[model samples]
Structures are given as structure tokens and as C-alpha cells.
Target: MTRSTWRTRIGFILAAVGSAVGIGNIWRFPWLTAENGGAAFLTVYLLLVVGVGVPGLIGEFVIGRRSNRNPVGAFDELAGRWFRPLGAVALLASTVILSFYSVVGGWILRYTAASTTGAYFTAPQEYFAAIDYGLGAVGFHVLFLAMTVAIVYLGVERGIEVSTTVMVPGIVLLFGALAVWASTLPGAGGGYDFYLSLDVAYLRENLFSVLPAAAGQALFTLSVGAGTMLTYSSYLGEDRSLAADGTLIAVLNTAIGVLAGLVIFPLLFSLGVSPGQGGPGALFVSLAGAFAELPYSRLVGVVFFGVVLLAALSSAISILEVLVAYLVDEHGLSRERATLGTGGLFLVTGSIAALSPAVFALLADTLANVVLTAGLLGFLLFDGWVLGRLAREEYARGAGPIARLFELPWYYAIAVVLPVFLAFTLVTGVGGILGIGISTRGAAAVAVLGVGGAILALRRHGVPG
Candidate 1:
């Protein structure tokens, strides 16, 4: 059987961008920005996106396009069965993320519908608290998962590429309009100042604390660590420059994130709602409350939450596709069967999350970051030591002269610098999750040791550094 591939380069790019631009940008980015030093956090985040995220993205693209297979099979085909476990980590990462992500998608779906009826306008916090976790949440999660499965079942070109082609542009247009309207809101200047103005002293004081959060968000927002990008790139039927495509995707994803902050902060400040308040409920509670106070509250709410729904669906589709692709490529399941089976699995897992607050928080806040970081760490190691020069060959296959010039630097960044950085973040992430305080020196030692062990293992596998 001939495998499905993207119909056009633009289709591939837009679909990839759709995966990248999601709740992470619309919901999490503003909250993280607010919790950190606003613009100071944004500055560091942009640097990391450029420095760490893009190179990591290209690495996934290389692995995917080179193998032209799903994550698990990509490893089996490229290296050997021993490395298949690395791919399984990615598969696990995708499963872990989507299991909880569907629940959040359900929340966005409910809000989108509720917005039209002004259901939550009267008391947004109370409304969210009521429906956040229960049978009601499970119903919405199933609805959202069904929508995602429908698309994935339709296959790649007919479903994902086509839908994102429309959805991505709609997201940009809606967000642009919302940002413009947010600018006109009374006292919006304060929001802009809060988001854009850097606090050098705050950054200096809390740089260590903020770094881990920002790094995790960078990985999450790019959709890099969970094999979504790898799965998406595996559909690429052409040899267009992975470097160029990766950079463009990163830039567009960052722009959408910044634009989300523009819309969210201004609205929050207009209502005098602190962005940091409500924690995970910040969007559903604070922002929903802000929408309630607007002149055309219902309409504003509908448009805002509708945009979120689209973003959520786009991302959910990508994650679901990871599992679906695994089944189809590795097990020879039909697309329909694979998607339905995957949906059934999430139906159970997502309902579990929707029903239990503790489980949802554990998956979303803690395990998601740790698993994604570890998954990306495995990918970079494979690309660096196992694939070695072949990774560069795939990277430079269709790259232009300008992109080709940075091949060596890009390789080194992904091979040496990123693994070390990811190791540090992984340690910090685990420590933060377990409430075990790790000193800077301790974390650094762990990172170095982890990287050394990976290198030694690869060498023993007869892979040249």
C-alpha cells in the first residue's frame, strides 16, 4: 500500500504550523508570561526558541523525512530494534499529552458553546468550578475526541492538510482582529505595559526559577518533544528544505503566541484581573469573566472561545495522528481502524482525566513536561550519535546555500548543547514535580552525567560520535 503524503508544500507547512499553534500558545503562554517577569520571560523564550527549539525541530524533521515512517518504525528502520524504545518514548509522550489534552479541548469546546448562550457570563469562576471535572466534562471530552478522530480517520491529505489550511488562516485573522479590539479596550495600555515592559531586576532576581518553566513552555508550544512533528514530517513526499520549513514554522508559532498575549493581557487588565490568578483556571475564569463585562459580551465570548476551540482541535488532531500513524505504519492497521482504536483509548484515558482533578493535574502539569523533555532528549541523541553524518545529509538534502552554511553549527547545537540543556531541564522538572529541591550544581552534575552516559552507550553500540 502506498502511504499518504501531503499534497503540497504549503499544505505541509500550514498543517505543521497548525500543530504548533495551540492551547500552549493561547492558554499557557500568557499565563506563563504573567507568572514570570512578563517581557523578560518573553525575551528569554524568544532566544531559546531560536537557539534551542528550531534546531531541535529540524532534527525531528531529519529523522522523520529520512525514515518516512512513524516514530517507532522510524527508529527501527534507521538504526535497529534496540533504538525502537526511544521511539516508544515518543509514542508514550504523545499518548500522555493527548490523554489530558482532550479533556482541556473539551473545556474549550464547552466554553465556545457556552459563550454563545452567555452561560458562564454571570459567574465564570463558579461556572468553571461546576463543570471542570465530572460527568459533564467527560461528555465534552468525548465530543472533542470524536471531532479529532473524525479528521484523523479521513486520512492526511483529505483531512488534516485540508482542515488546517482553513483553520490556521482563520486563527491568524481572528487573533489579529481580537488584538486590535483589545487595543481599544479602556485601560488597555496597562496590559500592554505589563506584557511588553521588561523588569530587569525581576529577571535577574528570578532567572534561575524562571528558566525551567520557559524551557518547558518552549518545547510544549513547538509540539517538538512528543513526536507530532516527526509524524507530520513523515508525510512529506518532497525534499524541500527541512531547515527552511522548520524555521518558518517556529517563527509563525512564536508570532501567534505573542499575538495571544496581546489579546489576553489587554483584556485581563481592562477587567483588572491578574493574569497569574486562577492558576490553570486562568483562561476559563479570569478571561471568561473579562469577556462577560464587554459591551457585546456573548459575541466576544463566542469568537474568543471559538478561536480557542480551533486551536485546540488543530493541536489535538496532530497528537491523535501520532498514535494513529503508529498503528497504521507499524501494525498495518487501516486508517479508520487505527483512528477509531486510538480514539477509544483516549476516550477511556481522557474520561479518567476529566473525572479526576488530581490525575488531570498530574498529567498536564508534571508528567507532560517530563515525558516530552525526555522524548526530545532521546531524539537528539539518536540524531547526533546513531544517525550521525546521515542526519546532516538529510538536513542538507534540499536546503539552500544559506541554510546549508549552518549545517555544522546546527548539528553541534542539537548534538551537544541541546542534550545538555534538556538534561538540566529534565532534572529540574522531575525535582520540581517530586518536591525535591535540586541545587544548581547538583542539576548541572546530573545533566553532564546523563549526557556522558548517552554518549558512552552510543559508542558501545558502535556509533561514532
Candidate 2:
């Protein structure tokens, strides 16, 4: 049987942008920005996005298009079966992401409906706590999962491409309109100050502490290290300059995330709400409370949460697609069958997250970050050390001269420097999770020494650089 392929370059790019632009952009980016000193964190994040994230994205595109296989099969085909576990790690990241992601999507969907009905407006905090776990959460999760599975069942081009092409543009338009409207609100200037103002003192004092978050957010915002990019690129029918596509996706995703910040921060400040105060539930609790007090509360609530629902559903489609593609491409299951099977798996796993706040926190905060960092690290090492010269050739296949000029440096960065940087991030993230109390400098030193020793061992083992 023939494999599935994306119908057009624009379609593929739109789908990738849809995957990248998600709840992370809307909820997490602004929170991180507010917590880490706004413009200062944004500056470091943009640098990392360019320096680390884009190259990592293109690396996945190269591997996927080169092998034309799902993550596991791609590694099995390109690097032999011995490296398939690396691909499995990518698959694991996707599953871990979507399990909690779908539960969050369910929450967004509930908020979207509640906005019109004024269900949560009476007592937003209590309402959120009441519905955050147990049977209600599970039922809502199943509803969200059903919508996701239905789309994936329609196959790649018909379902994913078509849906994102519409959804991505809608996300931009709605959020853009919201930002414009938000700027006109009374006391909105304070929100913009909180969002865009530079805090050199805060940044200088906490640069090292913030670096880990900035790096992780760069990866999370771009949807790297999760196999979603690889699976999307595997459907490509032609070389359309992986470098160009990766850059466009990064820029669009970043723009949307920033725009979301514009909408979120101004509204919060206008209503005197503190950003990032409530953890992952911050968006639901704080924003819902904001909507409750505003004039035209119903309209604002519906539009805001509705846009969020669209963003959540679009991202859920991509994450779920990763495992579905694995089943179809590697196991020869029909698309419908594969989607159903994956949905069933998530039916149980996602319910666990929806039913337990602790499990949801574990998956979303600790497990998701560690797995995504580890997955991207594997892909970069494979591109730099394993694919090496061939990876560059793949990158250059349809790239213009301007794009091709960065090929050599891109290869070296991905091969050596990025792996070390990502290793330090992985270490710091694990330390944060385990309460290990390792200093950022200590983590950096350990990561560099570890990479150097690994390079020497690989050289002695006759592995190609």
C-alpha cells in the first residue's frame, strides 16, 4: 500500500503551525514571561528559538523526510533497529504530552460552554475545583478525545491539513481581535508594562534560574522533541526547503504566542489579576474570574474560551496523530483502526490525569519537560553524529543559497553545542522535579564534561562524527 503524503507545502506548514500554536502559547508563555521578567525572558527565549529550536525542528524534518517513516520506523530504517528505542522515546513523549493535553482540552471545552451559560461565573474558584477531577472530568475528557479521534480518522491531508488551514488562521484572527480590543480597555497600560517592560535588575539577578525555563519554553512552544514534527514531515511528498519551513513555523508560532500574551496580560492587569499565580490552572481560574467582572462578560468569555478551545483541539489533533501514524505506518493498521486504538489507550490514561490533580501535574510539568528534552537531545545527536554529512545534504536538497549558507554551522551546533545545552536543561529540569537543588553552573559543568567524554568514547569506538 502507498503511504500518506501532505497535499501541499502550505498545508504542511499550516499544520505544523497549528501544532506549535496551542495552550502553551496561550496560557504558559505569558505566565512564564510574567514570572521570569517579561522582556528579558523574551529576549533569551527568542535567541534560544533561533539558536536551538529551529535547528532542532529542521533536524526532525530532515530525518522524517529522508526516511519517510514514523518515528520508530524512521530510526529503524535510517539508523538501524538498535536506535529504534530513541524513536520510542519520541513516541513516549507524544503520548505523555497528549494524555494530559487532552484533559486540559476537556477543561477548555468545558470553560467554553460554561462561558455562555454563566456556570462558573458565580464562584470561579470553587467551580474549577469541583469539576477538576472525578467523573465529570472523565466524561468531558472522553468528549474531547472523541473529537480528536474523529479528525485523525479522516486521514492526514483531509483531516489535519484542512482543519489546521482553517483553525490556524482563525486562531490568529480571534486572538488578534482580542488583543486590539484589550488594548482599548481601562488600565490596560499597566498590563502591557507588566508584559513588555524590561527588568534588567530582575534579569541580572536571576538569569541562570530563568535560562532553564527559557530553553524548555523554546522547545515546548515550537513543539519539538515530541515526534509530532517528525510525523508531520514524514508525510511530505517533496523537498520544500526544510530550513525555510522550520523558520516560518518558528516565526508564526512565536508571533501567535506573543499575541496571546498581549491578549492575556492586558486583560489580567485591567482586571487587577496577577499572572502565573495559580499554576497550570491559572488561565482557567484567573481569566475566568476576569471575564466574570467585565462588562459584556458573556461575549468576552465565549470568544476567549472558544478561541482557546479551537487552539487546544488543533494541538490535540497533531499530538494524537503521532501515535496513530506509528500504528498505520509501522503496524499496517487502517487509519480508523489506528486512531480508535490510540484513543482507547488515551481513554484510560487521560482519565487518570483528569481524575487526579497530582498525576496531571506530574505528566504536564515534570514528565512532559523531561521526555521532550530527552527526545530532542536524541534527534540532535542522531543528526549531528549519526546522519552527519547526509543530514546537510538533505537540508540542502531544496534550500536556496541563503538558506544553504548556514548548513555547516547548523550541523556543528546541532551535533556538539546543542546536545550539551539540552543536556544541561534536562539535568536542571530533572533536578527541579526531584528537588535535587543542583546549581545551574554545576549542571552546566557536568553536562559539558559528559558530552566531551561521550565524544571521546564514540571516536575511540570508530563512530563517525
**Highest lDDT against the true fold, candidate:** 1
Model 2 alpha-carbon drift over 4 Å, by segment? 290-296, 453-465
TM-score, cand. 2: 0.94
lDDT of each: 0.88, 0.85
TM-score of each: 0.96, 0.94
lDDT of 2 by residue, 1-465 (tens): 688889988899989998999887887777678777778888888899989999999999988998999899998888677678878998899999898888888888889888887888877767888888788899889999999999999988889889888888888998888788788878789878877787889888887668877887888888899899999998886659999999999999999988987877787776666765556666777678767777889888888888788788788899898898889888999989999999999999999999899999888767887898889988988887777788888999989888999999899989899999999988887887778988868999989887777555434532353
Model 1 Cα lDDT, one tens digit per residue, 368-425: 8788889889999899988899999899898999999999999998889999999998
Give candidate 2's error at residue 233 in angstroms: 0.6
Instruction: Itemize residue pairs with steric clashes in candidate 1.
Output: none
> Backbone collision count in every prediction?
0, 0
Best by TM-score: 1
Per-residue error for 48 in candidate 2, Å, reads 1.6
Candidate 1, residue 73: lDDT? 94
